[model samples]
Target chain A: MTIKLDRPDERGRFGEFGGRFAPETLMPALEELETAFAEAWSDPEFRTEFSEILTTYIGRPTPLHPARSLSEHLGVEVLLKREDLAHTGAHKINNAIGQGLLARRMGKPRVIAETGAGQHGVATATAAAYFGLDCTVYMGEVDIERQALNVLRMEILGAEVVAVRTGAGTLKDAVSEAMRDWVRTVEDTHYVIGSVVGPHPFPWMVREFQRVIGEEVLGQMGDDLPDVVVACVGGGSNAMGIFHPLAERGIELVGIEAAGEGIDTGRHGASIGAGTPGVLHGSATYLLQDEQGRVREAHSISAGLDYPGVGPEHAYFHQTGLARYESVTDDEALEGVELLARTEGIIPALESAHAIAWVARERRRLEGRRVLVNLSGRGDKDVEEIGKRR
Target chain B: MGRERLSSLFARTRAEGRAVLLPYMTAGLPDPGTSLALFEAMAGAGADGFEVGIPYTDPLMDGPVIQQGSERAIEAGTSPDVALELVAAVVESTGLPVLVMTYANPILHRGVDEFVAVAAEAGADGVIVPDLPVEESGPLRRAADRHGLGVVQFVAPTSGTARIEAVAAADPCFVYAVAEMGVTGERAEAGGRLDGLVGRIRAVTDVPVVAGVGISTPSQAAAAARVADGVIVGSALVRRVLEADSPDAATSELAQAVADLAAAVR
Candidate 1:
């Protein structure tokens, strides 16, 4: 198999996993966006400007650092892709800047996004501020409490943060609220979706934007391919970015899902490993749903990983055997956070620590081999919440 | 039982020189008993047709009012079975054309063909799935047609000519014309594109067209009904019923409000 996944095939479907499951009112807007993005991608001027901005402003080609201490401890050559070094302190800025530019190109003066852990919110706010566009981010009320510093950072960056108080008051509800906002304000506003979820174009488009990570890794790694590549899967954007370009190039692609308390307890966010395919938030992906097909609330210590649905592409990858998915418990991920801080002097976001936790699980098997891990965001925003976990 | 009843209702309303008044109520909301009473009260009040919503856990396209009603229904254990029973009871009591307006996931979970058969057997006249667009509606539409259940399709103000054609091709009993680019809610007035969209839809099909979303006040409904065949009042009626102190009070107040709403459209 060439790993040729011709998905979203004019109907936004990845082998029936993804489609535009939105309301009638949003259909035209989504169509308009699809057309605009295609045109932007083809236009030389547009590509040049977007690339220049990504390189100079958002800080591209985030370094691939050799984690010597982690390597010695794990007995494998563990290298960390420092997305934490990006300007907004996470890899989310890559897509945010791309969308901000796309918003401008489409003559949309306002942009709105939904955030879980607030990294995407801050990145969006920062990009919107730089580009002189009005920005608003919808965050769940619970997340607003859990990630207070990020909310403050968004405010300071001049983006309006609306607290969504629906459902479980988490990422899922925040995205729903943002969709509601867009339905009411679609004429001049662009819905800058945070992750690779939602309707058509988002999963495909977000992957295209984040593909820079994998492309850079291929160049940095020189002639040899790593034996393993690992990244945490929340909505799976960061993982998709690193995994897509290197898809056909044979390397073990592993995605770590958050197993909040445990999968058996039905409290985890491991949608793929333990979920059925269903439509939610504009996409038909793997979802935690009841027999009545109502979306079940997901829980995780890390707000970013606490969602009931995964991206559609990740579902395809799982089915095609292109990637293997595993779950890490909240306790295990926290331990990974502690281990990385102590050994490598790097504090990773709890979302990223899920990948670090994978290393601990496969230390013996991965010995004498090289592995690449996407360290998605810094753990600075998580310190306060981590402190309270005790 | 489905489209024929709806056809007769509209024909009668048309002969009377008044637009049909389709009122939406969230099923099993505020407890099943009250929800049942509210439907009967609405039928007696002057509703030409009824659109009953099966409350889902996530009603992404709903406004605050309907969302509140849906959450209440969900909390009160209004699953698909419960909602179907509610639909049956409403139809048995009212003897009026009643349509089930719900999201697609529930039906998809139950098996589309099975769901349509069950809904028809339960006395639902028709169904309106907001998220299932015409392109992805082949299976459900075929099942609905086989069961004589009208599968209502929608055309939004933002829809292009091709989509308008596709929706027309779906040949719904009535084209659900979205009056605005937003979720179901009470607004000061409807969007300004009702005439344009209704006119475009009329050019394609002879199906009856009903405008919904943001048409709240009696005057707003009348204004919108001028260009369209009928109007569906959602958040406003749902809001009024929610505000009444008692179910009996709710019955009278809601019935009176629906009558007033009927008169304005007339």
Candidate 2:
């Protein structure tokens, strides 16, 4: 009944990384988030209401299946933390639901979020509709074309979709444009960041909101923790959500990046694994930049993972040797998509498929040992891209 | 050798009571060939120096006009390597004191030492990175010094005395005084507070302090030059280029603007 975290440093980040790095315009809205989250998370009545909705309305405690066929093919035990079964069809809804509730509690009349593949947009829109809040989603023009179905799904949920045409006309630009809008309408709006990227407080805040995934997975796995935990890193929200709790549990955590090509080929979204420290948007994090510190164009088949920069916490994690970073090429991830579709009838998001593929290829090293893979999202949005590739 | 030459050049201009005209244009804007022609035209028009803006996608401190110019350059597929080549062309055509102005991101993306090496190789006299504050200028200053390139620094009106002292200490060339709070853009009139700001900066360092940002008209340049050592005209000149019927006309108009401003100050 009682929400555990509270206040400015809710997620407990050391200086330099975890404060809310919002502009002057968005300060009121961010302050509103602080007040709303504090109240909603602690109020037993609100907690019970959301808990019942998550369990009955959204299907909580999704089954943890031992991927037997996948294990057999890979010569090891592979377990999937079934986040794909969550309502809105991805783990993104978990955080979205929490944020939407907080938005309602704060008396905010409108909710806004930026999306790349539109999964987070759809998830946020779903929660907004459930809470009866006016929702607006900013999506990149390119992403709108790639994830047309999800865009329609958002529109069906009654959320206005605004296409951003600045910078690269992708996720980074979309977030920038949305933040600009939120700045102007801060008093009545809440900007729900989809991942653990953004300035201060966001990386830590989103992680805490989604840490429910790690808490449940640890409990569901019982007495024996897996030898390895693998999760795809797109802004690293899902990976960080599940990895943070298990980090001290002595289990190895691997965050797989969407490498459009191999790392050596210089065309990929492996920010932590392949990028250098540089400032982009607002935060100083690992980003793909040229010698003059200009942001370079990032390429990845998975729209969700194609970002030039990674979250600052991920950069911190990589720098402190707290987590291992890996890369999965588009071809390898596509194989993961096909593997899951054929074996378990589960179509994972191309972003999540990166982790799935890593598990398939790396499971050999952990033969006969347990491995928990964070099924970050489902593949509904990626069907078009996959179909074209095939 | 280059700093000495540039300093002596500034001294001669000051002694002759002639205002120094620093014409700025983005590399490969319009096109590389036209950029070269503009540089030649400005030099032939008795321009004192060149502040070459390296085209970047997100120029945090640039105005909309310069932002558009950068976008056009990027859309034309201008790369840093190509920009360096353009700088080389400008230097070859006009043996003038050239300052490369850009944001820190591109240089960091490229590797600091490599950028300095390339810029120096391109015959650039100095470099100005607007976003790199005095606190973070050591590495870049060292690199520039090693390559014999002057590291020009900016002193804003908002900077405290400590920061002014720090900037004066860090910068090798004349300190650039940003005339206003915002990015490079034309203003109807030069702000009234610049004279005091220039005097305040002068109290800290003996280096020549050049006033930039919003000094558009010949009269505005004359006013700025009365208080400061030099005047920088960026967005106004870029607008002249953009509004001109052709690139040739743009260069001629830009040259005229520079000559008119210099004569007014003189």
Candidate 3:
């Protein structure tokens, strides 16, 4: 089955999903930003400037290394897209820099962001410092406790960190707080949404920024494309980044979700497999919720993967049969970290481990074929948690 | 208690040279039983309208005060069924028109027709979905219309004239003018942008326009009522219920607060 792929419609819909579901107060701002992004994207100078910064500042074109040992072990030539090598130790910096530039260009002197695992917070802070834009990061109190090092990194880089204590005090709540801040301060502030979720233009604009991941891969490959590409899905930004350029490629694209305990145990972050489509955090997408429609708290060892919803584009892909989804348990993800560390001498973030585990499980089918995995982030932030597990 | 009945209340207020006084509260805040009693008391205290909230696990548009109230209510087991029951009881007790203020997921999950039928059966006059934009509200609006229920649409201070026209086409009992740029919260002064929004809304729709979201004080209510046909106060009086020492005290205090705002709207 072929999936018909194109840009979002004028209303910013990916098929029947994704629209501006925010309060009316935010509608005018969204329209304004949408227009600005279109104009910027069309400008040749903007593209050249963005590319120059990615190359010089963010350390882009991260190597696509062939994992020889892991390949020999699995009987497949497994390739790794080393996004972990990016300046902020994650792929988040790529999108943050683009948005930070846009914010500055729009003359919004201040920027705000929400982070779950703190990778986005650090990335935004780094970009804000680069552009000399005033920055504030809203983090869940629970996340601040888990990812304390990142919080310190953001603060030392000149961004104010606020601990959000409302609701479940997780990524969802943090995004809510950031949006509330944006509503009042929008006159001079730009909300740097860290994911391909929330209202329109956001999901669309974030994809536009992150598509560089796939574009770079295709450009570097020249002729031969991988038989399969894999990335873990939280809000699915990185996955969409890689998959979108390859969506019409007709190759296999696997997005691994976190099955915290197990899918059947109802303690997982697999929104596409086990959730219904509805609105949350201002965008209509697949969400984990109860029969009464109260969104349930998602669980994962990786703070970044513990979210109740996936990006609407992922939902669109799922509906169109363009991309297939699989899930890996926390135990399997931990084992994935160990195997990659031992074999490739490369440490993976707990969130990225899920993708690594999926490749391991599906290795037999991919034997002697080329595959790519989005190594989204480094393991430095999760070493303490992994140590505790051991 | 339906749209026609709700319309008459607004008509009476307009003819009296005043705006309707709408008081909002979470269903099971400070507990369910007392919340119902407080609604009855507010009606007696001269409230012209009500917006009853259904507690959800996630309230993206709510500020800390209402979030706390919703969390408490959810802990007290105010599910969709329970919330509908409370609506029914409020209708029976106060005989005042009520609108259920909620996010979109609950209605979508319950099957729009089923939820609308239940709410209509429970005597709800209208529904206000903060996250359901006018463009995507067709299915729910159709179901609500079938049940003779009005679906209220909100006009934001930042809304352009085109959006104002679109919201006006939703055919609400009244256009709820969001008095500020942010989520539901208490503010000392009504937003400076609110009057401009109300005037723009008046140009689009013939229905009454009600100012809401940040009008916390009696003076703020008075200020907002000058440019609109009514005012709706949430976070303010709900905070009073949270602070009162007892449920009886909450009822009396809330009633007093509603009365003060009601008198000010005139």
Best by DockQ: 1
**TM per candidate, chain B:** 0.96, 0.96, 0.98
Error of 1 at A279 (Å): 0.3
lDDT digits (tens) for residues B43-158 of candidate 2 = 88878878999998766566668877888887787788888898888888898888898876677667789999999999898888776666446778999888888887777665
Per-residue C-alpha lDDT of model 2 across residues A249-302, encoded as one tens digit per residue: 678889998788888898998888888877665455788876655677777888
lDDT of 3 by residue, A1-390 (tens): 435455688878888788888777787888899999899888899889989999998888999898999999888888999999999999899889989989988999999999999999999999999999999999999989888889999999999999999876788888889998987778789999998998988988899898999989999887799989999999999999999998768688989999999999999999998999988887889999998999998888888988999999999999888899989999999999998999999999999999999889888888877899999999988888898898
* Retained true contacts (fraction), each candidate: 0.66, 0.18, 0.76
> Measured by TM-score, how close is model 2 to the native structure?
0.70
RMSD of 2: 7.2
Q: Taking the tens digit of each residue's C-alpha lDDT, what string does model 1 give over A1-390?
A: 345554468988887778888888888899899999888878899889978988898678889999999889888899999998999889999999989999999999999999999999999999899899999999999999999999999999999999999888999999999999999899999999989999998998888888889889999987787889999999999999999988877899999999999999999999998988888888888989998888899999999999999999999899889998999999999999999999989999999999999998889999888899999999999999888875
If the candidates were sorted by their lDDT against the true structure, best first, what order would they fall in? 1, 3, 2
Better of 1 and 2 by lDDT: 1
Pitting candidate 1 against candidate 2, the one with the higher TM-score is: 1
* Cα-based lDDT at residue A278, candidate 2: 73
What are the per-residue Cα lDDT tens digits for candidate 1 across B22-93? 998888755777888888877787788789999988888898899888887788888889899998988899
> Candidate 2 docking: what grade?
incorrect
- Candidate 2 vs candidate 3, TM-score winner: 3
- Scoring only the second chain, what is candidate 1's TM-score? 0.96
- Give the CAPRI rating of model 3: medium
TM-score of chain A of each: 0.98, 0.93, 0.98
The Cα error of candidate 1 at residue B90, in Å, is: 1.2
